[model samples]
Target chain A: MNIYLRLVYRNIRANLDRASLFFELIFPLFFIFVQGFGLNGIVPPFDVGNGRVISYSLFLAAGAVTLTVINGGTNAGTQLWFDRKNGMFEQLLMGPFTRAQYILSIIFATLIIGVAGSLLVFGFAFPVLGASFAPTWEGALLIAGALFLGTMFFGAFAIALSVVLKSSETFQIVSTFAFFIFLFTSSVFFPASAAPSAIQAASLANPLTYTTDIFRAGLFNAVTPTVSLELGVLAIEAVAMFVIAVFAFRRIRV
Target chain B: MLMAPDQVVRVDELSRHFGDKIAVDRVSFDIARSEVFGFLGPNGAGKTTTIKMLTTLLPSTSGRATVLGHDLKTEGRKIRAQIGVVQQQDSFDQGLNVETSMDLYGLIWNVPKAERRRRIDELIGHFEMQEFRKMPTVDLSAGQRRRLQVAREFIHDMDLLFLDEPTVGLDPIVRRSVLDYLKERVRQGLTIFFTTHILEEAEYLCNRIAVINQGRIVQIDTPENLKRRFGSAKAVEFKLLQGTSSEMASALSSSASVSRFGRDEGSGAYRVTTTRPESVIPEIYRLADRLNLTVSSIYISETTLEDAFINLVTEDEKAVANGGRAS
Candidate 1:
């Protein structure tokens, strides 16, 4: 097997546990099943722009996929901290592996989990919420791009954070705070246009907002000009975060 | 230039510094094929640092080294591919069981599936880890974890192996088993670069031992030769038939062969430190006859490698204290 694939396999096998299952599959289900339906009568249908209005369930389902990807990215970064703390960072480097291969393995593993978890959410959302699954070729390609770029961006950001922080306790605290901030200020729960002006501005500046927007457009088969702009911004952010992650990784002692 | 073909590792003037403080200072040594070269030192004595540099885990600050004919600076990956290292720190996935961990390590090295199973079985049996093979690593004891860490290295084939305190946190029986296993590997042409704080283990397993103090190699020789050279004084102890003996004390103090004399209160014996045990034993017998006291038991104890190691390190410390550098 190739070195990257070997490492990715190891990562997947090691990380597949009850906590991972709850985060990737169950947590998203709760939001789509409980929160999405619980607010159906009170919140009204979401206006996804381009004159398309969808039920609150469909909107939160799209956000669920992006949320799963975000969690996957966070797990990838958290894994790096654990590896360093447990001495496997030096152990792997002592083996027939380079720093590049090790970091890339994390990215690939996160990508796999992100795509798989998103599919599971979509599978469960359509059945439980009485929604339909139909997407044009363009919409499908857009969804693929959104998942890939979203996984790459968050994965790199988390990896960079993990390397910069010194202790695991600090990493957990900072990551939890960052995760809550990014989730709320973005379009994962509510549309930016429906929020206050300050939060609207914050959502516009947040990359998670772009990821959720692009994913929502693909799910509804509403690939508009705005989706193109969101995809472009996400691609740029992914590349930028990747470069920063590489720089941070170079500073690691072993 | 690379070392001769028989020399698996050649380190010359290799040093490592952390900002302003030096960890390994211009240490030079060569390990021949199938040789068990021991690095003996106290805590913070640079043994692990030297191992880290030689194994290509850490870069050196100055000088040069080569392992298995590959240059340390340029061909580190090549060297890493052909060598195995068991560091002082524990390295394993806590989620995986012992068998799975060993199997994963073999898979990382690209070993075949069937062969990985065979090596895992062999290592588990040799290291006496059969009972915990299915247990998660987080539940293992420290000694079991250390044993697992050392055993996992053998899953992949390598000509040279570096072990840093591999037997630490192990019971005497298990520690001896590990030493015997290492000896078997060395007999089969595996060269080992070993580091340890246990002088007895080094004396038992090392073909040649290097005593390091303050990041410097103070002495390097075979264990027997080390004892013979630095441990010249013999401890001659004799138990008197009579309990209290002021006459025997005076006789022992006035004798020229006895350099240092004291009574061992626990054993009810008189202990003497002397270079010439032959003359000292006879002088005790004659003194007993003149004092009208019967000689019960007497014996000469040989100096051990631990004694020699302390002597060398103590002298090195004194020398460094006087001149700010070890001789």
Candidate 2:
């Protein structure tokens, strides 16, 4: 078996317990459930200047899944942090592995977590609250594409963050702040347009905004005109982040 | 039957620096097949740093090394695959139990199932860890953890093993047991690179011992050779009662057999270093009688590896201070 796959397996198995369970599964579900259901009861169901009558709960579901993918990135970074802290990082580097192998394994591990976390969101949202995975195979393919590119981008960011960050305390504060900022500035819980004009402008550049829109487009079976541009920007951003992560990973000392 | 180039390890001008601090300074050495090469040094004397370099855990700053016939820089993964390392610090996958940790390590090293099982049982019995093999590493005692850390390396076969202070935190019997096991393995054609500050362990297990101090190799020779060369000056220690022994220290320096000695400030005991303690010891008593000095206690012992280590390091410092001429 490939060592990178073995490492990814180990990372996934070692976590997924209490601490990771909350981040990867429970926290996003809780947020989506309370906010998704709460807003559906409060807000009058309306579309954003479109012919379709979109439910707020379904919109929150899209944001919730994006959050799951983002959490996967954080999980990937924490694996590097834990390995360094517990001496396994040296062991990994000392094995039949280069630094690139270790970092790639984290990227893959986060990709798995992000996909699984999204599945959990979709599974809950569709059955319990009557949401849908895009109606057509083409719609489903777009969701899959967005999930892959989104997870890859943030996963690379997390690993690159791990290599550059000095201490765990600082890493936690900085990554958490980055995660929340990304969440708030984008369309996970609400339309970026619902926020002030400044936040709306910032969301135009936030990669999560496109990812969330892509996800929402799939869930609502309503592909919009901007999906192609969104996919193109995401693909470029994902490649850039992964390239940066590779460079940073190479420079790390055992 | 021996090929001249069958050295399992060869290092030339190998150096490592952390920023401006030189951790390993242009060190060089070789280990032949099945030879136990002991690296002895005080704390922060580059012993662990050297081990880390050879084990491929840390990259060297300059120079070259080859392990199991692979270059250090380009063939690190190959070298790592062929050698086992027991680091100085005891660490484990805290989430795994002792059994799981051992099993996981064996798996990572690609040890096959049947062989891994056999080695695990053999080592667990050898290291006396069966009682708590099911316990998580977080719950093990310091000594128990250390034993597990050492024994875990035996789960896979390798051409060479690097042990950095392997016996530290172990009880006397266990320490000797571990060394004896290492000796037994060396007899079976395994090469061992051991590092320790304990001179006795080096003297016991090493075919050749390198005394290192301050990132430089002070002396590298067989323990017997090092002892024979540096052990010529035996030490005579005597305690004084109701008297300052500073006067006696100066008087003994003139004796032909006594080369040099000093007084222990805390114990008020005078140590006389001499090639012939027979004459120097009696001269001490004679000098004491004339001075009306009351003797509390006195004894003489042969120069040991501990003495050789101290003397070698002291000579190194003096040589450095005197424009490299003091030695």
Candidate 3:
């Protein structure tokens, strides 16, 4: 096998434990079932920004799929922290692969997990949530684009953060704080359109909002020009984050 | 720059500084094929830093080096592909069992599957890891972890292998086994760059040893040459069948040949360090006779590499304190 492929396989194999399983699959399922069901009766159906309306479970299922992407990216980036602690970071760099290949393998592995997790959530929702499933070619492309761009952006951002932070304690604290802040400020749990003006403005400023918007729109076959516009903005953010990650990684001492 | 055909590593005045602190200063050396070159030093003595720079894990602040005929700066990837390094720090996947970890390391080196399986079995047996082969690496004892770490490095082929304190934490028997294993590899034409604080280990395995102090190379020579040059003072000791009087102590202490003298607390033997043990031994006999003390036994002990190493490093420290370079 190629060096990059070997590294990717190593990353995936090393991370396939119970803790990662909880974050990648079980955690998202909790949000989709418990939270989605608890609020189903009190909260009315959601418009989903298209003419058709959907149940609360169906609406939150899309957001839950996105939760998998976030978790996958976080796991991918924290892998670096673990490798550094265990001395594998220097060991791998001194192996056959270049620095670029090592970083790209990590990002690529997260992308694979993110897309697979999202598809699994989508499959679960189709039979369980009683949601309709039909889409144009463009709708499917928009969902694919959202998963790819969003995973890349978060993977790179977390990697950059891990490289800049000195200790694992600080990394965990900052990452958790950032996760909750991004979760509340974005359209992951609720519609930014229905939120107050302050939250809506903050949501608009978050790149994750654009990702969530594209994903939700595509899930309901509600493709619009705005979804494409959101995809464009996400692509730019992903590229920028990737550049920062590479720059920070190059400056690392070991 | 092209190295000689026999040279696997060639370092030229390489240095690394962290801000104002120099971690590795202007170090230069060469390792020929099939030679086990030992780097012996005390703690925090730039041994690991030098290994890191030579292994392509860290860049030097100045100067140059070539590993396997590839430049350290521009050709790090090429150099890395042909070399193996077992670092001082422990590195392995905690989630994987010992056998799996070895297999994964083989995979990283691009060793074929069938060969990886064959080597895994061989290493597990050779390193005596069968008792814990199925145990997770995180749960293994420090010695077991170290054995696995060293054993896994043999799974792949490399022209030059760098081992930074590889035998640390091993029991004496296991340490000897590991050293013997390395000797077998050396016989098969593998060049080794070994670092350790164990003087006996260096004396046993190294064809030539380099002693580093304060980020500088203090001395580099064969172990025998090192002992001959710096450890020339032999220890002369004589045990008295009868207790000694004050006169006998005074006579031995005032002798011209004996420079340092002390009594062994357990054996009641008078020990003296002298440049000329032959003269000192005869003088000790005369003093014993005049003092009416019976001399039971007398012998001259040989100097060791540990004595030479301490002598060199102590002299270097004293020279630095006096603002002079060590000779």
Candidate 4:
């Protein structure tokens, strides 16, 4: 077996804990169920500025899928923190592999986790929430591309983060901070049109908003403005994060 | 044997710096194949820093080193592939059990499956970890975990092994077992770079020992030669029935063989450090009898490795105090 593959497998398997399950599966599903049933039609009907009346649950489910991408990236970055606390970093640095290879393994493993997790949430949402949704070929392609690029972008960000942060408490703060900021700015709970002007502006610049747009367009068959532009931006961000992560990892002491 | 002359590790003027402070000075040495080279010093004596630099774990600030003829800087991966290290701290995959940890380590080192199983079984038995083979490594006792840590490295074949205080928290029997295990490996043509602050273990195991102090190699010689170089006086002890008196102090000070005399505060016994204990013993007896001092006990002891160790470190400290250092 390839050493890098073995390392990645070990990391992913090690992350199989109740907390990971709750964060990736149960936590998002809880939001989906509560919003899907509790607010399906109870509130006054409101239309987005574009004359599209989007349901709250569908919007939340799309956002929840993208949440998995962010979760996967942060979790992957924290794997290095655990390894450092346990002295495995020193042991591995002295082994046969280079530091870059070790960092890459974590990134790849987290990418797998993010993609699989988003797929799980996306596929299971229809039967669980009773939402009648199916994908056209173009919709499916955009969703897959967005999830892939978003996972890579966040995975790279997490690796670069793990390289600089020292304590787990601080890392938790940073990850939680990033997650909530991205969650609120993106169209997770409501369409950007329903949010205030400030949040709408924030969403315009947030990479996650573009990812959520791609997800929403595919899952609910909604029309996204300039779909190709979103794909290009996501691709560019993913490439930039990967290159920076690889560059920053070299400065970390053994 | 020291004469094997294979020179598996050759370090020249190696040094490491953390910020402005130098952790390891310009230290140089060589290790032959199949020899147990012990590095002895106290904590913070640069033993670990030097080991880290030589193992290619930490880059040196200034130096030239070659492990297996591969340069330390450019060929680190090649060197790492051929060497193994057991660091001072305990490291294990907490999620894996003892047996699985061994298997995974062997697997990471790219050992074949058949050989991995064979070595795992052999190491488990050899380290007396059979009962805890199925237990999680994080839950094992410190000594048991250490056994596993040291034994797991043997899963891979290597030309050189670096052990940094491998028996720090072990019992006497386990420590001896670890030493003997290392001895057997040395006999099988494995060169070991062992660091320990324990003088007795160094004496029992090392063929040639290097005494490091304040980030410098103060002395490098056989255990016997180290004692000969740093040791010149033996201890002669005398216990009197009563507390020490002015008369006994005067006699010891005027004796020809005795150079230093003092009463131990704890035992109230007297110690006379002398160059010639044979003549000093008779002189002590004659003085005690003449003064009507009831001598309870008297004994002459040779210099020990511990004594030699303390002396060497003290000399280096004094030299530093006097602003003298080795080139």
The predicted structure with the larger DockQ, 1 or 3, is 3
Best candidate according to DockQ: 3
Tens digits of per-residue lDDT for model 2, A1-254: 56876777766654334566565677777777888888788877766332556788766777787888888888888887777776677766666677777777888888888888898877876687765333788678888888988999988888889889998788888999998888899988777878899999989888899888887776566677778788899899999999998888877775
lDDT, model 2, position B301: 85
List candidate 1 stretches off by more than 4 Å.
B239-258, B262-270, B276-296, B324-327
Higher-DockQ candidate among 1 and 4? 1
Share of native C-alpha contacts between chains A and B (below 8 angstroms) recovered by candidate 3 = 0.66
- Each candidate's DockQ: 0.62, 0.38, 0.66, 0.45
Tens digit per residue, CA lDDT, model 1, A71-169? 888878877887887678888888888889989999999899888888888887778788775768888888899999998998998999999888988
Best-matching candidate per lDDT: 1
Candidate 2 lDDT over B80-174, as tens digits, reads: 88888887876667777888778777776777778888888999989888899899877998899889988998888788998888888899999
The candidate, 1 or 3, that scores higher on lDDT is: 1
Per-residue lDDT of model 3, residues A1-254, tens digit only: 87788988888776456676556687778888899999989889867766868888778888888877887778777788888888888888888889999999899888888889888877876578777778778778888999999999988988999998999889888887887787888888889888999999989778789888898888788766688788888999999999999999898887
TM-score of chain B of 1: 0.91
DockQ of candidate 3 against the true complex: 0.66
Model 4: what TM-score for its first chain? 0.88
Q: Which is better, 1 or 4, measured by TM-score?
A: 1
Chain B TM per candidate, please?
0.91, 0.82, 0.89, 0.86
